[model samples]
Target: MDLIRQARARLAARLVVVTGASSGIGRAFVEAMAPSGARFVLVARRRELLEQLADHVRDSGSHAMVQALDLRDVEAGRAAAEEVLAHHGIPEVLFSNAGHSIARGLRGLVARPDSVTRSVAANFTGPVCHALPLLGAMCTRGGGHFIATTTVDARTSVPGWSPNVASKAGWDAWARSVAPELRSDGVATSLLAFPLVATPMLPPARRARARCAMSPEAAAEWVARAVVTRQARVAPWWLRPHELLHAAAPVLTARVTAPFSMRLVDRG
Candidate 1:
């Protein structure tokens, strides 16, 4: 079978939970997979947007349930996870695709420490909190796939992106650390280390300047590929080499890139 058919076969009538489903790549992924006959649990902060997407999914003859809440709230995330489990049973595929980003230097970070908390909540604690319940249930059931949408930036640190990179890196590390254990339980984990994508997550100026970035729909294709293939990671070809360079000479790499990174931030 072709990839599309394979994906459809795998996901057909299965329950798939997707965070950040109101917009961007998450929304696109839901739309792309709707034709596969999957039932989706859409989690995001915006009720209206989630409702609209749910309408679209129902129109396409798929099942959709929207859980609208801010992932930044740890309690809310936990509660939402339990609610999803109670309502939908354990999802066959849990796409943990929600994240938040903030660009701030040490000075700015010091001035606004809440940025760090917010970033950590959105990218690390929140997602983990939300996934823990489902993960346990999935393990009990003995077969599932967990896909995390991380960033290529998590591979290497950059100036002015500490909050974003650090939080994403934490999530990436957590997912990798749990992968072997999850595998033993017949649960697979895949991480998508994505490059810049044309989404609302990017600043307007950066989005406009991001000529090489993939579109949201294109990014969704990567997620679908992960769902179909269950690969450990999906990333740009150059990312591994870039990561090696940073690992080999962290100080030198940081020093060399700091100016350019700051310049971009200033421009943004």
Candidate 2:
């Protein structure tokens, strides 16, 4: 227990900036890590929830700040990052977890182009806007961590998740490309590929009985651990083998998973 306490103490000293902190895995992350002593900057669109979360964090004996900004606005993201830098100095950790998804299908994009555009901006471009300013500073400082949540769909497309798959794929490509460039400067970047978590983001119908879906707390624990340990990529144990098979025999893998994947599609 002494070793665990020491580890918690070390992790608690770092400042962590979390996007999407109003709820879900982000809230769980705040709950899991705040007691360990880490100060947090919580960013989200909902001001009320952010404040409530801030109160919770302060109650836990950790400092908490709230930033209410829509990430789809690139300039806003940059501005928020600057404010954080000015007020709190360079953050040791950035949990770039803000994202959006169109769960129905590509039809939603055709029916609602603006929503689709915002979703793409939120998942890919928005985080990059926030990250660019901080990454440069982290490079100069020679120490910092940038962690973002991704999904297995980034690599393989699912039946009703075209927008989500595309957005994640774009982010995965961009982040992976930039990872090596940051390595020389000692800025660690990680893309955590989560399969499915039982969060509000998942529809009630889907979340009702998804045995394989991880709890938000479980996902948050992995994310917090990754931030503390500076892990480059966090993925389930089974994901690698599936990725390998998909790479080795794309057609065969797709054929095998088609029925199963299609079953989860919401045809509305």
TM-score of each: 0.96, 0.91
lDDT of 1 by residue, 1-268 (tens): 2565677779999999999999899998888887788999999999999999999999988899999999988899999999988887889999999997788888787778888898999999999999999999999999999999999989798988888889999999999999998999999999999999999988888899989999998898898889889999999999999999999999999999898777544211
Over 154-231, each residue of candidate 2 has an lDDT whose tens digit, in order, gives: 887565666677788888888899999888899888888988899888778889888889999888877866765777
Best by TM-score: 1
Clashing pairs in 1: none
Which segments of candidate 2 are over 4 A away from where they belong?
A: 1-7, 263-268
True lDDT of residue 186, candidate 1: 100
lDDT of 1: 0.90
